[model samples]
Target: MRTNLDFSPLFRSSIGFDRMLNALEAASRAETIDTWPPYDIAKTGENDYRIVMAVAGLSQDELAITQEQNMLIVAGQKANSDDVEYLHRGIAGRSFQRRFELADHVKVVGAGLVNGLLTIDLKREIPEEMKPRQIEIRTGQGMPKAETKQIEAKKQAA
Candidate 1:
C-alpha cells in the first residue's frame, strides 16, 4: 500500500523551500522504487561522506559517474555476450542509472571500484565568506566618543 501526503500546508508558510517540498512529493508519488544493485550511504566524517554500491560483474569502463550542480549520477551498462549459454541466470546484469541529490557546497572528491564494490567519496567545503566567525565585543572604556559641535546665534545688526 502507498500513501500520499499533502504538502500544501507547508508550502503556504515556507519560503524558498519549494525544491525540497517538491522532492518529497515526488518521492512519495513514485510508482516503483528501484532496489537492484544495492547501495549504501554513510557519513564517514563531519563533512565527508561515502557511497558504496554493489555493482558486481561491472568493470570500470562499463560504469560512469557524473556530478552536475547539486546532483550525482551513476550509471552502468554491461556489454552483451551471446557466445556463452547459461542454464540458469540469477545475477543481474541489466543497465541501471541512479541519482543522488547533494546539499549545498558538497562535491565529489574521488571514486574507486574494488572487489565489485564502487566507493564514492564526497566532501562539503564551505567558503570562507559563508563560514561562521566570532565577533569581538568592545567594552565601554575603550570606545571612541563622538565629536560634538556647538552652534551660536549671530548678533543682530544695529
Candidate 2:
C-alpha cells in the first residue's frame, strides 16, 4: 500500500527544505522497503549513534558501505559458491542495498562486524561557527561603554 501526499503547499511556504520534504515524500510513496537483513538504530551518546544489521552469511569483502553527500548506502552481495548443497535453505543470503539519510554535520565514524551483526558508528560534529552561542544583552540601568561614547560624540556634534 502506498499513498502520495500533495506537498505543493509546503513547497511554496518552506525554503531550503527541499531535500527533507523530498525524502519524506519518497518514503510515503514506497510501499515495501527491503527488510531482509534486519537492522537497528541506537543512540549511544548525546551525538553518537550506531546502526546494527544482521548479516549472518556475508563476509567483510561481500559488503560495501559508502557515503555520498548526505546519504549513506550499504550494499551486500553473497559470493557464488557451488560447494554447499542444502535441501531446505532457511537463512537468507540475498543481495540487497539499503540507504539512510544523514543530517547536516553528521559523519560516519567507523564500522565493524562482530559475531553476525554489522555495526556502523556515526557522530554529529557540528562546526564551531555553526554551534549556538549566547548573545550579551543590555539592561535599562546601564549602557555599554562603547555605546555611551558614541552617544557623547553625537551630542558634542549637535
Tell me the TM-score of each prediction against the true structure. Answer: 0.86, 0.83
Off by more than 4 A, model 1: 144-158
Cα lDDT of candidate 2 equals: 0.91
Reference-based lDDT, each prediction: 0.96, 0.91
Pairs that clash in candidate 2: none
List model 2 lDDT by residue over 61-153, tens digit each: 999999998999999999987798989889887899999999988899999998989999999999999889999887977875654443444
Best candidate, lDDT-wise? 1
Most TM-score-accurate candidate: 1
